[model samples]
Target: MLEISISSSLKDAVNDFKIGVIHYQNIVVDTLPPLIGDRLPLYYETIQLSLQEHPVSEVPGVAEWRSIFKKVGTDPSRYRPSQEALLRKIKKDGVPHFVHSAVDLINFFSVQHGIPMGIYDLDHLSEPIQITIGSDQDSYPGLNGRVMHLSGKIVSVDRTGAFGSPIVDSKRTCVTEQTTNALQIVYIRPSMELEEAKQLIQKMAEMFTQVHGGNHEWKLMN
Candidate 1:
């Protein structure tokens, strides 16, 4: 089973922070089905309308995340959280281009719930994972080809090193077509209760299995 723990270093910064993890096995990671792909345009439109009336800055979850980022020393405006970035992109582009089944699913939920999410291929990770605040010396190659300097950021570290975060995930553990087993992490905001977060993770995992053909389980960690 996949296991994760919050570091004492991170607890000092934000003790109430919680992470929801879903582990999936025997999954097919490919293009999303037309049924799901067809709905994204509608989801994007809803987000676009929502953003026009309520700016991303004023979003409850987004606002809380910005505050958390400041507490950790990173400029939220400079390195916006992943969910905020996605909302901005959808507002500007009118719709999001698909990545793959797993990624596309997570992106959809992130936008729907205003939560930051990260997914990694299980085969690439080391056991006994930890969530901690990044130091100045920690950096990883990002999915976008930029090297992410993780100082003061919330990051996931395995035995290997820092591989994932709320802002952006490292290329090292990114899920792709070859990924048969995967780990999805949801960064729950303070506005959500632990029970709500647990339900959300359960729903997400069920959806993944429903759409991607997988066996899955989820856990809540603090």
Candidate 2:
């Protein structure tokens, strides 16, 4: 059974932080059909246009990407690159590629929705996965052994602090074919209205099933 646990303190902080979630039930694993094959390239283009037209500042969860660019001493106005830019660069640069059905699913969803979503191998997770704010000293390893320093962002964290933000997945719990259970999280922030966010989540869930084809269950929490 899939299980989700949130700290009482974290739950209290949600309203204050203006964050909310529509989590699926842990025990229910439904695989929708896969539309990724037909839609990936188009969605990728859409994401690129969306980012170019709308600056990073306009996108939710992109503040971290902007901050990272700044920390590396890049000009936010001229050098700032959106997540789409980073992904495109990665694709063009011929970085070591890891292709899997779940990974592709997430990539397609990220582009289609303009929201960052993460999929974790559930067997590697501890009970009661949660959505909460990050601590001043919190950090987690991201793709390619890169450490994500999360000082001031609302994050969804597993008990081990393995996968905290939607920006990237931790190598520790990344999804693989061996992964029979999984946790998918979509970061919903203050910018999106509650109803709209729910709609997006449902759309994503349906899309996942459409592309992947599995039996899964869903749940929502405020």
Candidate 3:
């Protein structure tokens, strides 16, 4: 019952801007777990360390965060946990593992791409997943009882609630072995160029194939 639609304007803009889209089908199993202990890849670790050291107040997006909160009616300053903190916990504690092929695939893709991606248990979601800005009350308790603030940024939501955060996800909507079909989404923000995004997507698809033991069959969006 899950329905997904990309707005005509958004699609047109993406086409005009030459944005890149990469889609993966079946995902691998073992890749979801951390390679060794709680250590993440260098890219993920570096970003986490930088954010922890700088704090949001000193970042270039501090002002933008304020504006986004105002627009979405949520206070970004009030929701100030470091992403590294959350990631480290997930790495150490282990996420609830899912068995769906598509869900696993996108998870790997997101990790490899160093961006946020999501997969919804299509059977569980309502039709037409809507993309919109979050409201003040749009917080969700994720893994480890952490509340995620979704106000003021784009999110893919169904009747069950948010499937993915801008750069993270809530365990509430995560896919599992019971999932039959899935709706996968990868966010290619405005800042990323088409070619670079495409290359990253390609690499991700290739990696999925190599690790999961599958053939490549990707469809482009823009």
Candidate 4:
């Protein structure tokens, strides 16, 4: 079984923050079906329309992400939410043609709920995982082979090192075609209530099974 927890250090820094997760083991996806890609355009359109009322930064849960970033010593303007990044990319260019059902499913849910998410291959992780504030000395191989500094940043880590954060997930644990078990996490803003978090994660669980053959279980971590 996969287990997740928050360190005392992180709880002390941001005591009330919560993350919703959908963890699945024994998933199987060889190719992304047309059905998965077909729904993305509609989901993107709905998100674009809903976001008109509030700028991505001012979106209810967004300010909280920025607040945490600032508290952790990173410039909020520099590191935007993954949701904002996705929406911006879609608006300027178009909905990304994802490589597989796994990537597409998470991206779809991110836009639909307006929450930043990370999907990590569970087999790549070390046991006893926790989310904590990154110390000034910490560093990791981030996406695209670029080394990233995580000092005073909020990130998920295991025995090996940090793998995921609100800003981005590390290359070390990124999903690939070989990925069978996935650990999906959605960052929650203060504006999101527990019940809402539950619904969102559950929806993700449903969508995963619908798009790709997977069995999932979800829980909210406070």
Which structure among the candidates has the greatest lDDT?
1
Q: Estimate each model's TM-score.
A: 0.96, 0.67, 0.54, 0.88
Rank ordering of all candidates by TM-score, starting from the highest:
1, 4, 2, 3
The window of 10 residues in a row where model 3 has the poorest summed lDDT is: 13-22
- TM-score for predicted model 1 compared with the true structure: 0.96
The candidate that wins on TM-score is 1
Instruction: For candidate 2, give the lDDT.
Output: 0.55
**Residues 36-149, candidate 1, lDDT per residue (tens digit)?**
888888879988987888888888878888988887787999999998888888888877667899999999998888889988999999988998899887899998799999
Weakest ten-residue segment in model 1 by summed lDDT: 89-98
Q: Please write out the lDDT profile of model 2 over residues 20-73, one tens digit for every residue.
A: 233233322333234435555555555556555666466655564454434433
RMSD of 3: 6.4
Worst 10 residues of 2 by lDDT: 16-25
Clashing pairs in 4: none
Error of 3 at 22 (Å): 5.6
What C-alpha lDDT values do all the predictions have? 0.88, 0.55, 0.49, 0.76
